[model samples]
Target: MPTSQIAPFRLLRWFAGLSAIVIVLIAWANAWVVSSFLADHLFQREAAVSRDFVQNVLVSDGSINYLTHPDDPELQRSFYKSIEHLSKMHDVLRTNVYGRDKLMLWSTTQSLVGQRFDDNDELVDALQNELVVHAGRITPEIRPKDEYAGLSPRANYFMEIYIPVTLPGTGEVVGVVELYKAPLALTQAVQEGDREVAVAAVVGALALFLSLFWLVRRADRTMREQHTQLLEAETMAAIGELASSVAHNIRNPLASIRSAAELSLESPEDHGAESARDIIGDVDRISARITELLRLSRTGASAIQPTDMVALLQDCVADHQNTFRRRQQELVLDSQVTQAVCTVDAHLLQQVLHSVLANASEAMPDGKRCQIRVSEASRKTVRIEVSDSGAGITPEVLKDVFRPFFTTKPQGLGLGLPLAKRIVEGFGGQMTIDSQPGVGTTVRIDLPKA
Candidate 1:
């Protein structure tokens, strides 16, 4: 395998990179849209104020009637006199009034007074009753050198607004009121709006990225858990198939052997009776091993519910009483808690108890003591302890006790302890075994309290 394949790209880094790209793009787009909107909004407000100034203050006293005969020096003088003082007070660099013929009718700068500006789109649109405001910066290349000369040294930005003057009753366009003013206030307002939009975009982008990261991380964990379960399911399926094959091939022969041995024992002849008895016991042990394999293959967890472990332990002890007596083993039950309730499948819990108890009884062939103790381990859990007074396991054998199909006894299939432990853990419980060589073995099971 290549070195690149040894350490592949992880999901977290991939998602984080993708999230950063997407969030950055979104933030940029939002800033652009909000900035454009704020600039347009401010422009519209300024245009409204300019229109109001032209209609109400400049043309209010019927001086607007002078534009029809715009070439008249007397009318031009009267129009300039009326608006000149007000325009200069408002920081107007230069103003030009254009008639419907696209002729510069009136001007604050004497050089442009008679000039016809037919190429001026702002004046043409305003002549058709449109309110046009063109905003830009003043440069050395600006046209009509007369107006550019009057501009202030500090005022780089300018607002050129065009307002149409109509008759009193009928809404008609006679001439355009064009004003060239410095935009110090508008510049300040736009700068403030840009700062606010930039801050908002950054905060919003961070929030979105964090949310996406959290959701992706949660999904990654869920995927890993599902993958582990799929592997476990495939393993169990393979084991089930093997167990089925072994049982199909070996069970019938073992049964026939056992039956033949029993028949020979029934006969009066004692010649081969002892050997027949031995053969019968061996066949029965093989059959027991086969049955254990079948059970192990079919093992799975059932839903857990509240169960009174005191009654469960008593019932398990009672069920094995006759068997224990035949083996000459002493069974004792001791409990600190009377009604120790735990969350587990009742049938599966009984099976676990049976396996451990049977193992304990089988450990001592010469009638030794075996005890079961129940107690509340904590507010959240209940504990069951099973100890046997038999030849305890050595350290080497003890470590492998819960390993599947690992055993020391001659006929042991070695699935009992492993199966028991699996059943206990299936319902969110724990099982542990402690043993000292030549002393005894004690198994403890802890289950969550209901």
Candidate 2:
């Protein structure tokens, strides 16, 4: 409630003020439009009333006595009565008749019985049967000084219509019927109201624009901060995974070395030489494991190269050909993938295919043939499928198949599927698995086209 305190509530209040300003501006614009329409409607209504008065009342008797003979008392009464009726129908200031000489013979106001209106040529022309209607400044010189009696000093802002009055019997023009109506007051009032509305509308529009701009700015900043936080979190997760693997992988080699050293210590006389040899072997194994970890972590290690996909797949299947034969299993390769060339790292991709194939072969029951299917799924990708006829992985096992360190085999490290996933993703590809418990399992690797 303080005048200077700026809190979150105050900020939100500022936004509301902006919205209010926009609302005011829109309201003002609508007001202006309505005012303009009303003004136009008023003018049209005034004009229509003036026209109807002349057409129905002034010319109703069909006698031009009011114009031809102003002294004819009988005809004069009818004219005065007609003027009275017209005056009743509208807010008419005055109505009068002018002759060829430009003298006001008669008027609704008895005071202007014989005043001369011989000033403007347009009025003169109207007396000569040239019906004229004009709306603008009126001067005393043109419209006899007494004509503006009982009217505003701004009477010049009035709109007057002059219509030729003709005799009923003969089609001869006798004089003119002039009708006066002022609109300055109404127009000015409406115009003043419009100015207020316009001010409100402008203020509202500015406030709304400012509010939207600030809100968007705030949202953009929040989004950017969130994006940065997400990136950091992802980076930390990767580091954590790397750290875990480093500890786990190093433990095995370190354990092997410790065992070799302990054995040598226990039998230092005869088995010491053999123990030393075992130590060297342990060190070599640890070095190899380190190399494998480094390979897995290296960035851009699987950069693509244009190579024959069919040839690479052929090599992978050939390597497993012996394994299949030794296990008394059949390895059938569908060689319909002749035209399949792709951009890929030949060695890394071969490793992925070979791993899937080896898994497929191992998954099958002894003497069961594992069918290997390789072909182009489309022009943009090559689909390599390895399906085994053996009992497939169960739902629980399939769920964690691709997880790091998850394995079903007795002597397996459970790292094969995860590594395969990494290698495939590195090449901008995907590997998917589908299996049924009692049926068979199919591992499909979809690779990008060359």
Candidate 3:
């Protein structure tokens, strides 16, 4: 209910966890859909551009007829005219005629007019059976380093084309016509598209991440504030229940002591002297018990501190050793523990140990073995086990063990174990009990590393 008991750490952690999940989903979605689509589109567009470039290299009908038929010189003239007509429709760059032997018979470009292309299988195949040879960049096998170096002196440069030429007059079999171009242009286009997709994905992911982070963090802050208020309210309610009982138990004695002291002041005689001393002692003892009850006021869970496990349990043991001895009880201590370093409140933790010890001591009527063991469970936690060979708790009693003032003993105003559980839990530790009807009972406290 009060504003002073709020914590934000829990809320922040929740928000961070959720925001991470959302960002990952966004990134995966972009990769699966947006990026893939862009890549496919770029490849298709590049392939189309290469195809268009190949169609613009027609110059003569003779070249066309030579591709369509080997022995069709008559129709070759009409094919040459057709090629010239096709050339006029688009921007013609260069036209070259190659024989079946792959030598350049004629070329519109003066520089390549007499060039021999016999070694180029793409050209030879197109001239022979008019096979359309579409060649892109030469592979490593086709252009080994030494061989490619002697030919073109650079890598990643090539073209693609359907060459159209002729066989002997079976019909007009178009020779292979290569629409050749440098791979650099197409590759660059594809790479640029990829870069754009990458940039978009990064930008989109960052935007989504930031937005989700902010929203989640804001929600977490609000949730944390609400959770804090809830915990404080719970603590106040628990303390209130215990406080009412404590106030009721101590007030009667306090009033009796006050009335007796005032009466003793008036008398100052032998009759009141002994009675006064008895009343004062009783009041002092009751006040001590009330102080212990007041300490049970829950403060929710606090951060754990690094504490010495051995020393912590030993201190409680030493403090209660005399009480046990006075009752003729056997007190044993074992320090063979796995984990030593733990985070806990020194004062509150000691109180928990003392409370368990006192309860164990009271369980035995005459004398019994009260054993305390401190050992390590794992690297991150220390385990403290306090066991007693006394009248163990029954099922009915165990059910109400931590309920305030649910005492089995006639003289008990039971808030001890409940307060201890609260204290341990507040420090991110666990308190548990295992008991039998008659044999014994063990209380285990597991504290985490600092």
Best candidate (score: TM-score): 1
**Top lDDT prediction, candidate number:** 1
Model 2 regions more than 4 Å off: 1-292
Write one digit per residue (lDDT tens) for candidate 3, span 1-450: 667865635655765677668776777687668655754555455545533443343322234445535567776666556544433322223345555555554454557745777578667655554434232445667666432343433324344443554333463434444443334554556556657777777788788778877887778778876876577558557776776687787777697776877688578477877778787777777777777666765344344578888887777878888999999998888989634877777888888888888888888777689899987778777789999988788888887786666687777777777778878877888899999978989999988876
Candidates 1 and 3 compared: the better one by TM-score is: 1
Q: Give lDDT: candidate 2, residue 410.
A: 75
lDDT of each: 0.81, 0.70, 0.66
Candidate 1 lDDT, tens digit per residue, 162-199?
98878667878888888877766776788789899999
Off by over 4 Å in 1: 1-12, 71-75, 89-91, 106-110, 136-158, 243-295, 300-306, 309-338, 343-450
lDDT of 3 at 254: 93
After the best TM-score superposition of candidate 2, give how far the Cα of residue 203 lies from its true spot, in angstroms: 40
Ranking by lDDT: 1, 2, 3
lDDT of each residue in 173-231, candidate 2, tens digit only: 77777777665565465566667667666776666677776886687668766875576
On the 0 to 100 scale, the lDDT of residue 436 in model 3 is: 95
- lDDT of candidate model 3 versus the reference: 0.66
